[model samples]
Target: MCSTVVTPTDRVQPDVALPFGGWSAIVRDMSEEQSTSEPTRAFREARDFLLAHREDYETAYRDFDWPRFDRFNWACDWFDALAVEQPGVAALTIVEEDGEVNSLTYAEMAERSRQVAGWLTGAGLQPGDRVLIVLGNTIPLWEVMLACIRAGAVMIPATTLLTDADLADRITRGGVRAVVTSSSEAPRYEGIADHCIRVGIGGPVDGWLDYEDSRGYDGPVPEVDTAAHDSLLLYFTSGTTSQPKLVEHTQVSYPVGHLSTMYWIGLQPGDVHLNVSSPGWAKHSWSNVFAPWNAGATVFLCNYTRFDAEKMLQVLATYGVTTFCAPPTVWRMLIQADLSAVEIQIRECISAGEPLNPEVIEQVRNAWDVTIRDGYGQTETTAQIGNPPGQPVKLGSMGRPLPGYSIALVDPTTDEVGDDGEICIELAPPPVPLMRGYRDAKELTEESMRGGFYHTGDVASRDEEGYITYVGRSDDVFKASDYRISPFELESVLIEHPAVAEAAVVPSPDPVRLAVPKAYVVLAAGREPSRELAGEILQFCRDHLAPYKRIRRIEFAELPKTISGKIRRVELRADEAAKVDGGERTEHSYDEADFKQA
Candidate 1:
């Protein structure tokens, strides 16, 4: 049976004698200072500013000031300040492919980044010029990121897994002026323009600047004026539903907006936070760069080429990772592994990127004796809704809105506030962490920002207690025989089966009905793709779901996905329409007629 918490009718009153603690204690300890009589004034100032202006858009936008600094560097001003006092504190730790370990201290990283920034300046890298950072989870990757941050240069982060075509698209679209990558991957950029300087990290490549020499620079850190509104990073959206759009972020948006993330993750000073996310994705910056560091927590990394669940568990035990965040895919894999044998010291386990299935949540809670909190957000924003530490977590609901966020469920057709519809922000000119419109797409931005609200394009339903439940993407949802169908709801149920590894549900074209639900599934290890297995899954869904939401068809194959890991339901929907036009049907499908009693 699912361990689902029913929604409450009103705000939960805090009890005085709660065992673990309330949110206040978490926030206070997270922002506490070291070796000083006063609290961390800088953090407190920033947090107080945000709290004072919470939900007040005009005052927050107009008066909530950015940190004043004519000669300010986040690495130097913030990180260096901490490093000088705590030189031995671990800043970054990574596990290598050869079973060796590498770690960098706060002071060492600060000095290294300063040297790299000086070297890049000498190499003719100027402020405002875009640099494409394509590297894996290595020490140099973090160094380069901090160096870029210190240099006041806009960074276009690309994953090492990107192909030549993908690189070409980013280079052309992002207007990159330089490139930094490992020497082993230098061959991919052989024919690119000479204007784009190549800085190889590992070793000297032909005609490329060697990053190793950057360590020899003995000059003091270069000083520059970095305004808060200045663009710090440019991210390309993962093109799951459409073409990738360049998303721009300012110095303050991520740096300040992640206050909510720090609170959501329950990060505290002296805590070690481990997040499983590849470089180039926004989530990497969310957990690895901004959130944990904002809370003064140590950012930990466990690098692996291919995922090994057992090895990951051992690392958590060995490293004493205090807080952890991973996507649902990783969490699902962990449930299938022998979790009882692994001892995890994790205080909190959180899931984002997609909604967490109730079954997966229960399995982990049973094994680890900790609740896995569910969070909601997008590539364009910070954590909007989440079960913060000490808050009640309702199963299948993406918790309440975070402290600063105000969510309204508006009926798209009626343009009125309702219990279920498009999730939107009612305040005109939405809050921080929201993208400053899609880069170079004015029409698209205006369309999304219409009706005096920022539309999420995703649908959700809210209960009387304000707990929001994710429905489905507006485009992916459809009606079959006058009944609305949510693909995510059905897909969530399908993944509960032990035979299923991943599943994507879409509407299959039908003659009598407008459409019917069809599931595309990836089988787990040791499971075969067969009609018998497909029939078993179909039967399981039919037994669990309501009659209107039953899975009528099944296909055993790899689900189509974007370059990023998101499943592409749009592609599946189009393919199903084409197949129906061609008079094709899967042999394993079952209709209501197939289950009739004579």
Candidate 2:
């Protein structure tokens, strides 16, 4: 058993007497040292600049300078330097579904990555070569990731859930020169490319290189010289509207951008951080890879094929998770379970990916005595706006901008700064954390970066306190009879109904009103998808919402979502529009027709 003690509020400090055997120990000591060391002039200067105009958007927007570095390798400069003395520190703790657990110390992970790097280099993988990595939440995933980073090679991380078509598109579009995947997935890449080398994990395959043999290679790993601006990752965005666009990140972009994420999570050295996210997506990297590790906290992972709120709660209590982050969907599911029976040691709870409904936040706070803080960002950047520690968290607002980010709300039509409009980053030259650009789409990239801002393509409203409240996406919010209807707003209210497990609201075309609100709802586990339940939800909407915003039509169906688990509102809207075009019209909706009498 671990001897480190933790308070309800304060983080666990480094255990000096504990055996320094893993990645966790190395990170903890490093974080502890950095926290006490006098802040560098550069760090102080950058921090002061951010504090000076924490809420003064106009001034910060004009005055702030993004920190620049001509030579910086995060692994070598920060991680490896810190790992030298703390060889036994635990770096990663992974709990499998069947209760089996695996851990790696910082020193062990570093050496393993070095060996993998040596093996990869010996196999003719060169710096800047793109390698497609598709694997689950496993040790080899992290080993190969660090190896790729050390090798100065770009990686395209793909989720194993992707289909053959998805893999084909990524291989072609990403210009993948190699692939490192499980032996189970070797068949997917059979005919793709002859030049692409396949490094299979978990036993040898007939045509693929064995990952276990990589451990035996006696070759010394060469340090590849890498610049901050070199491409490091190419992420294909989960397509909610159109085809997935390849988002390019530089060596410094994510490595540095995650500073914002670290601050947002309020992670500290020796803290055990658990983030609920799948492999391959940006959020996974945000919490699982960069944020916790950046802060020298233990990356605690609980892997399950299906989400089990009870099982997760047990892990949090058993593993002593100090900080926890999850999307709203998971939080909503947890709310349905009896949280009172679960013991959680979490110091802070955070929500991301989508705007967390205020009801869910309040419910968790009531039960767990911890606020579920909301945060906002995209695949293109790290946590931009979030409710940080020691800050007042408004009920529904995603809090103020972080240290390195400068957020602006510009009116879409006027292109002038405003209290309510499209969110943008007003950088003279874009910040280091911002993606290099959408890969190979010069026209799209140019258009997005125009108007002196990196347009987020999402809408929001900023109040006097600088807390930004998310509105629907630019395309998701539609005008019904000249009144702007935010689907997210209505959906938030809709999900509060007992029958609704999930909900997506969109505009349904109407001749008289131009458009009307329609809801596609997924029923809760025990609830049947019937007209009676639909009528109850529709009535619930009418009781809570304004007449104009009340859901006029409801369809019992599963909400369409991107593979990343974000609801595809664009697809929902397109389907509604098609229904209208097909002349499938509702004569009387819930409000117009008296359902109470029936």
Candidate with the greatest lDDT versus the true structure: 2
Model 1: weakest 10-residue lDDT segment is: 1-10
Off by over 4 Å in 1: 1-42, 47-73, 585-598
lDDT tens per residue, model 1, 37-71: 12234544665554444444345434543343323
Q: What is the alpha-carbon lDDT for the whole of candidate 1? A: 0.75
Candidate 2 C-alpha lDDT tens digits along 423-524: 899777677689889999999898889888999999999998788999978988998988999888998898788777778888888898899898887777
lDDT of 2: 0.78
Model 2 alpha-carbon drift over 4 Å, by segment: 1-66, 583-598
Q: In order, how many clashes per candidate?
A: 0, 16
